[model samples]
Target: MPSWDNTPSGTMTAAALSLPGAQPPSKCFTIENYYPKPTLPSQKWVLIKVKAAGLNRAELRGRNGDQPAPPEFGMFVDEFHPDPPKVLGEEFVGIVEEAGSETKFGKGDMCTGFIYGGGKAFDGAYAEYVICPAQRCFRLPETSLSWDVLGAITMSMWTAYGSLFEAAQLAKGATALIHGATSSVGVWAVLLARDHGCTVIATTRKKDKVAKLKSIGADHVVLEDELKEQLKRLAPKGVDCLLELAGPDTIQTLALPNLAKYGSVVVTGVLTKQWSMKDFTPALIPPTRKMTFYSLEPGQEDIEGVESVIADVISRVESGTFRSEMFLDKTFPLERIGEAHGYMEENKAIGKVVVTVP
Candidate 1:
């Protein structure tokens, strides 16, 4: 096995965006010493032997330094300890190696969750073993679903659930227009919207994915160029909610003033890789309609809320109401995580690229 340290027996290998001497974005990631099953600091934390870790676009953004810590968050800097270089993955499916005394989980249980720090605040799930708060870890059913599929569920489904139900106030019989309909969040939004008895109008730049979108319960699928006409024809009453996954271009062109009175638009994913909107003003929105930019920052919400979201999403996935395998594009072994990152950078992956940690 390739390693950065001579003591491979004592530590597990992890793919890090930038180790002590490594720079990011354009540079290759390095595998370095990652301690598996570290000392338990408190009775609320649990150690996990990572089986699979899912790659997300946010990790790329973190690699490029696109996200920065908020100023107020600096107040807690005193609580942080000097640790090894940060690892860069968020979602994972793993086996519980050690459950804390107070945790309800047990050893040998199959579990899944998002690392609270995740490449920013602390070292994350790009390693063979990860430690997370027990409340954040949810139990998984004994099913034939691949680890990659379960890994893909956490971030995407949680983001979709937050955006649709929490932010947009989506309801049964509502009309939802999802921009970037082929994205992971968009795909989940479509499925969830359909499951809730909503009329889903989905959009994608790829014409070939139209039928696939319809098969997943989209009431109407339209090319990006034909969005306006199709929305007018199918939903006549402006959509009740708009899922802005494509970012600025879609928000500027499709969101503002394009809703029923009291309708909302939740901006979530930026699949367009574009963040800013030019010449934008709140005046563009019609009276009574709202536009919200939703964000699920780590540690931003209470532990109970995060745990609830994870539990609900996991239950939905197991019940067959939400198909977890639909967004999986491919998997790579831990040593080839660079290839996985490269695949995602190329925009060739239709779904998620995961890394299998053995």
Candidate 2:
């Protein structure tokens, strides 16, 4: 067990939200001292000294007070209530400062993973130290990647993996359409699809990102308006898989119509901030096609499977199959977290936005 006596300070700095969804990003957070440094909550939880933390759209939704409610029937019931003043980063890469008696990790082991209600349910990675359940943490492999790059990957990459392989059942030769291609998860989805031997068609609202998406291994990059026409020419048989990140705004009109006879659509992230379709019905879905939602809520039965996906991601990065550098869009010091949130809210970033903790 690590001794708290040797620790430098009992207080840590963090960006906290006292009132969510009431103010702009610039005015939403308050950086101040958080006292009595967080301790291990259980024998299965580890304390992490955060090196770098990644931002997610979920945090934005939390800050804006517009997050979708958890599914009523799953393990997520009552699992997502975020009580502020709270810390809000969902993913991070860091060094283990203290390990639980039952954990496989030890002090100084580099680690990264997701925290379910990070910022809302508890203090998150925005601080110098954060607590994570041992089962949710992944021991990172030896690599040359910087902390910021690794920090930007965890949650987004995991979501992409779950959506493509687990939820959508993407095949090696499938044609994958990644809507909202410039978002962090969208970028990873594109790369993962290409690496898995699929032809990737990525879509973005802006014309400038077309080249960036294509350069990242997308076989075809089309504007949202041009997707219908481009798909007719690129894949007349229709796409085999669709990773819908844009949510209700485009899923019905743009996504479902472009699917192959037996294609699957995985609705993962709601980037548009719209929760439900007005007057939705099962009849809207085409016959023989399927749609599902994907989420990585804590305490799910399949939580153990995260370790394998993390290992696969790190292995690909180490073997040079996945380009880790292309995923980082910007980095901010922990003090500039408000700016980071603002950047993501404005859609100014192409990939992941991370915060480096000193």
Candidate 3:
């Protein structure tokens, strides 16, 4: 019989799983409940007994029927061998139930990595069981690493690290402007930039989020709509760097004439509102004036650099110094998955809304 455990750091990753007499694989959440069928064992795969997983906005895109199901073994199986519908999930921490022949992971190991999107392209952490590759799995430190905490940081940390180091190349004491300061990455960016000695000016559309942002160590938090006035208050010299999570829509805001000489803006969103700057002249806000559209896709431009820095971020998380409850405002049981999505859609959450798998 398939078995499970709830002790997050224990041998079992799943709080539940198939038993010998249990019915065939079937999904528990969402509109489409595909039955689980047999999945092929891979030379490079590991079976994770999921304990908990964190939610990201990317998963919402898939849930809205926008993206393809996560790359399952079936897709690769057709290219490699035949497999069945795989579970979908992204950021999760669980015990390794099985490891491939050449894997660095072993049975009973606790690890966390990107699950992609749960219930959409991938069978995410909403379920008790999940399968992944050893290469994609990053091990949790033996000490002080809690499952919930690990799940919380993987995605946000990766996004923040990639933007700060790879895209913005943030320098110590640089003046930074962060939009959506109350969001998970926004809060993290504020804290991280501070660690580097940067002075930050942040923004939020809702005024009530001010105290929350300040609690997380923000230098300043202003309403999103007040950019004109807020920009004045932040000093007319503009900023040395801007982190734009507001997406394509707000790109024009960074073009404000107030930006400092050679300032940079690193972006990672798809919102439709936008800002435009007309000066294309090399002498003016030149193309040499940097702008980066940050995406966390796993590839050569990021591959090694993203992993190493995330490892460092995880180390900080392990130490508890980098822990930010700012993103963990709400949580749901695996069954309340629908409500969780709705809560996020309402935009009522100040930080992160996570799902507990147990």
Candidate 4:
């Protein structure tokens, strides 16, 4: 068994970045080249032949010269880069080719986990094969879940699950006000909440998306701006839970007030603009409610529980209890990776987009 505390457990290959970032309008974009494969370890690691990987905003930020590789990733504070040369993608779904001795998983299993250890500590999933700790993956049903959806769903689905069940401690009869219902993660939250038999009020920006939210079993759908007023008339008492993916930037006019007692606001995204609530002190009349933000990073204590959640998601998706489309709105071959980042930056797609390994 490889020891995580004393030695390197997972094996890694020498990184080769072919295209790094966007190119001139006339020249087709591609990723840049980097060092050769650097061999690491696989003793306590699982080798995944990455079949598909999703395009996420964080990677987009790194690719677009916005997100810099942080200190923990081995780069000094002064020397980090976020161009196409940096390995991209944190989430991917693939078949495990081997397992670390310390881990319970074996080769040929399919799974995915959040990899926020930084672009340096963990190479991005846009590759032929890579390694991850055993705890980062979970087994999947033989006939269920497309690799694309499985890979894409894990992060969003887990966040939704953790936030609703663990973070919010929601009850069966609670009313969950879910913001950004059109988002991939937002829609998943609605499904998980509905699965618990909760009344979910889904909010979206486009009225055309109302039907989409309903198809996912939302009890009510309202425009983003109209969230508070519509719920005021619909639920009257205020929502018991608010699943916020838009972060702290969203306007507060739609605040949910129908919660019975000790309602909660769970924030996952940072779209709320400025976080000024720290300046305001709420009076103690609303039954001692709480506000919290969900960090998708799974903690050490949650290793096994997360695996259970992964199994549930895979089982449900395979059983038709959860029906999801390939979140891939677009794909760029490994060579055209630069262009892929550009597409995400352009904000053209609605669901999850991925860069397919050629």
**Taking the tens digit of each residue's C-alpha lDDT, what string does model 3 give over 266-348?**
87543322333344443544554677666544343444554566578777765666664754677777666656766776677
Which digits, one per residue and each the tens of the lDDT, describe model 2 over residues 1-358? 2211123347888877766776567577777776447888776888999999989887887788764455411232455453432777767899999998999989999899677555555667888888887766888867677888788777788889899998899999999999888999999999889989999999999988888898889998989888889889998988899999988667788678888999988888777777678777889999989888887655553755776677677777767777766688999998888889899888888889999998
Q: List the residue pairs that clash in candidate 1.
A: none
Global lDDT of model 2: 0.80
- lDDT string, candidate 1, 138-255, tens digits: 7776766678777777667777878898899898999999887777678778888888899999888877788778877899899988888877788776889999987766676778
- Root-mean-square deviation of every model: 5.6, 4.2, 7.9, 5.2
Best by lDDT: 2
lDDT: worst 10-residue window of model 2: 1-10
Over 4 Å off, model 4: 1-35, 41-44, 68-85, 118-121, 251-260, 272-287, 296-301, 326-350
Give the Cα error of residue 215 in candidate 1, in Å.
2.8
lDDT for position 327 in model 2: 80
Compose the digit string of candidate 4's lDDT tens values, residues 326-358: 233555556655566566556555456665553
Off by over 4 Å in 3: 1-41, 66-88, 117-120, 255-258, 271-285, 301-320
Q: Against the correct fold, how does model 1 do in TM-score? A: 0.79
Best model number under TM-score:
2
In every candidate, how many clashes are there? 0, 2, 24, 32
Q: Rank the candidates by lDDT, best first.
A: 2, 1, 4, 3
